[model samples]
Target: MPTHPHSPAKESVVDLLGMLAYGELVAFDRQSIDARLAPDLRRRAQLSIMAAAEMRNYQRLVARITELGADPQEAMEPFVQVIDGFHDSTAPRNWLESLVKVYVGDGIADDFFREVATLLDPVDRDLALEVLHNDDHSEFAIAEIKAAIADNPAVTNRLALWARRLVGEALSQAQRVAAEHDSLTMLIVEGTGDLAKVGELIKRLMQAHSERMTTVGLNN
Candidate 1:
């Protein structure tokens, strides 16, 4: 009998890919809804474009999972509840809040995956980096947020508070996922070669996140 075309992948890779796949899928859904909250048609259309990009990224991740000989849906299943919970808890109330969520929340996630991608095999690392949110989306969100802050200085306090909440919730969810997924945790530990380095990695992620928050005039 012929064997599968690709070699067996590590469990950590599957978990990472699965989590990312589901994340992309949910991002698409959230972006579509967020687009509706856009104050104007141009902004709404921009979000729609970003949402479509998310779906394409999801498809790419699913294809990669299949190539690894795993069921795409099964790979994504484990993360559904965890990811959904994060979204449910962080639901945005208005256009600016929605943009802040996209900028602050999704920015942290992309930063994390980009860091982790360095620890993966070349193919997986490349794919992970490739599927990340494009600069166009980030630029759009940042511009919108800064413009809002400029128009109404009063908006800063509210958005800054919302961003802080997002970071707190995001960190909590990350801890939950790390605690629950042994293979992924092991991958991080092994890649960094020590528990202390893992701590350093997290610090680096948070530091970068703080910079991003500041970039859009939000207090970290």
Candidate 2:
């Protein structure tokens, strides 16, 4: 592992990477499980392929953690309980719910990391952006959701309600993680150069989330 000129920033970067790494790992697991919920073999296979992509992203993050001279598992440990708790509390009961979780829940998280990645140094920023869910994944989810809603408008209200719950839980978990990790908080504050910008950041995330909901024909 090479030494960084800014050790504190390095620690923050490690925290970020660890969180993302665990996220990718869990995404892979969740997608594999949720694929079983798919109504048809085609959708199941498509989801399985997405799960494979997530695993590959996890491997990349783990390799980066190793390059930073940190134990990948150790770096990821701090986030395990929180991430797991979020998933446990928001477990999807059906195929549409699973797709909504993937689209809305995971979409917000990806937006968040993309925003934070801008504050990182060049190499880390690029890696972070590179590992996010691809456009194809988002398009697939949107298409499935829209098709479902179009076929049966009666399901719209229920799915919208589920999306609301997901947003609430995701925000709560994000706050918990930030509050518990001082280095990460400091990184954000320093990067933005103003504590107030953090509030603005949350607003932006929410706005993007709303747009996504609207995109899928769901009410925000």
The clash count for each model shown is: 0, 0
Model 1 residue 113 distance off true place after TM-score fit, in angstroms: 2.1
Identify the candidate with maximal lDDT: 2
Q: The CA-based lDDT of model 2 is what? A: 0.89
Candidate 1 — what's its lDDT?
A: 0.86
Clashing pairs in 2: none
Cα lDDT tens digits, model 1, 1-220, are 2132232237778988999999999989998998999989999999899889989889989999898888999999989988998888888999999889888766887888788887887788889888888888999999999999899999999999998888888779888999998887887887777899999998998888789988998864
Across residues 152-197, which tens digit of lDDT does each residue of candidate 2 receive?
9999999999999999998899899989999988888877767899
Task: Score each candidate by Cα lDDT.
Answer: 0.86, 0.89
